[model samples]
Target: MNFTFEVLPEERIECLRESCNKLMAFQKSVASIRPELFDTMNFETRLLPSMEKAIHNYTVVVKNNDEIIGYVYSNISPKDTYSNEFATFFDVTSVNKPYVGCLSQFYIKEGFRKYRIGSRLFSMSLDWLKEFDEIEDIFIFVSNGNSNALEFYKRKGFNISHDILDGFITVLRN
Candidate 1:
């Protein structure tokens, strides 16, 4: 299957809706594997809004035959106001530090996993964050159970910063 990777079209409602659907599906998939890592709230009421907000903030999605098969939500912002499931899991505290980029949400459809789509999405996000010179580093939290993701990030040069709850917070310097 052919896959196209690009920034999400936040200006288009249709695109946003597609992204929301993909996120919900991704959430469900994760919940099955690690229920504790996902919220028990409704997708429409809780998760969708957060996904929409991140799309508006900064995000990328991969499409196969015009269907959203993968996505990576990220942002370059101050650590204080940037909140996401991963960040919140760590209960990140506000600190007097420069702005940093975050790989907040990332998902790739099951069947598409072997195609390197997630890596492509991550590389794209890193390139986008590089546009902001103030972003000196990028952070991502991977669940300890998700060994594949941890290995992938490590292969990409991200170092494990520390253990956070049930996961490890990793970082990559730009």
Candidate 2:
């Protein structure tokens, strides 16, 4: 199927509610270790807070005709943001910049997989993240059991940085 990609502005993020929740459910369905962790994660708890804390945000939605089948959300935020109570996503001292970029959340519906729709979204998000001069590092976190996503980010040049939350998350960095 033909697909169109659009940049979803911060104010229009409401349209992502359904897709974002679907992404959390999809991650929970695939996670083998502590999949229950996703139970508390959804549009409100996850995406909304991230958007609020971020210094800059970029979201790309892929559409099939008028229906949005996939989206990627990214942001630039203080490096300290990763060191909160939940988990330390990376080594703080390792990054010299005060802020960092993250390809925060990405998802595509099942039927739309393998169409390179994800590749385009990935590129769009990565390019947006790289646009910020203060961003010293970029990260992508893949939940345990999502090898496809892990490999996808790896192919795109992000190395496996480390695991956090008892191996539930595999952090990738560029």
Candidate 3:
């Protein structure tokens, strides 16, 4: 199988929409197994919008044969008042800094797992974040139950900061 890893392009708006729907589906599937940990409704209404915003120049996707199989959405900017959900996942106030970047949403289709697609997408986003000198560190939240995700981030040098809303937010300093 051939795969391409790159920043999500503006011309591929449909890919963005499809990725969001796939992510929501993935979350809902997880919710079926651990309903208390995953909220499909909140993901659709709240997290989806944030991921959409992050798509602007900050998102990376892995495609196989021109089909998007995974993505990592991220953003960097001066800290400001954010949604309660955002605060719930990250220690926003503790940042106490001018600017920060966030790895907001990351997903790879079930069949595509263990293929290093996610790792390539994440590394691409980290490389993009490095271009911004103002960003102090990058933040990512992983479901406490998702041991695979937690281990992946840990392997990539992310440290657990604290628990939030049934998940542990991790940080990777730039």
Candidate 4:
């Protein structure tokens, strides 16, 4: 259960093979809870595409005994997609600005969920945003039905900035 966190460079993870396994793990995890979202996501989905594009800009990895246990892919988005949908239901009232670090993908293996790997990965994202020197804000999304994830973000001090009904997008301001 013990592990360490490492920030993987962009070049080290540009290829599909390097992070594909974890992507598959992430896909399975999302499918287990929200198949709809999972179905909409593929290798060509927004998360990976955006992550791949931002590889040179931002990326973070969680390592357990030198193995990648989880990762959070992020970049900027002018319009918060999720907000246009469920934000009203969650009573999200935050305003979206340009170039916000959009949290594209996040996942932790089943066995490693409780080991602070997720937190470490998230912290790495926050640290990157803080020092990037070009970003405006950081944003992320969570499925509405995924109570565990919602609660986890809440516990981590991430408030519901807005919700996207079409998919449920939650943003944490840092």
Index of the highest-TM-score prediction:
2
Q: Indicate the worst ten consecutive residues by lDDT in candidate 3.
A: 165-174
User: Least lDDT summed over 10 consecutive residues: which range in candidate 4?
Assistant: 84-93
* lDDT at residue 78 of model 2 (Cα atoms): 94
Cα-lDDT of candidate 3: 0.66
lDDT of 4 by residue, 63-130 (tens): 66767667777665444333443244222234434345655677776687876777777777777666
Instruction: List TM-score per model, in order.
Output: 0.70, 0.98, 0.77, 0.68
Off by over 4 Å in 4: 14-34, 52-56, 77-97, 171-174
Off by over 4 Å in 3: 31-48, 51-56, 81-87, 166-174
> Candidate 1, residues 22-140: lDDT per residue as tens digits?
55555545443444444443435433454444422567778898887877877655654445544553234533355667776677877889987887888888788777766566677
Better of 3 and 4 by TM-score: 3
* Candidate 3, position 98, lDDT: 65
lDDT of 3 by residue, 88-120 (tens): 444566776667777777889778997878778
CA error at residue 72 for candidate 2, angstroms = 0.4
Q: How close is candidate 4 to the true structure, as a TM-score?
A: 0.68
Reference-based lDDT, residue 57, model 4: 50
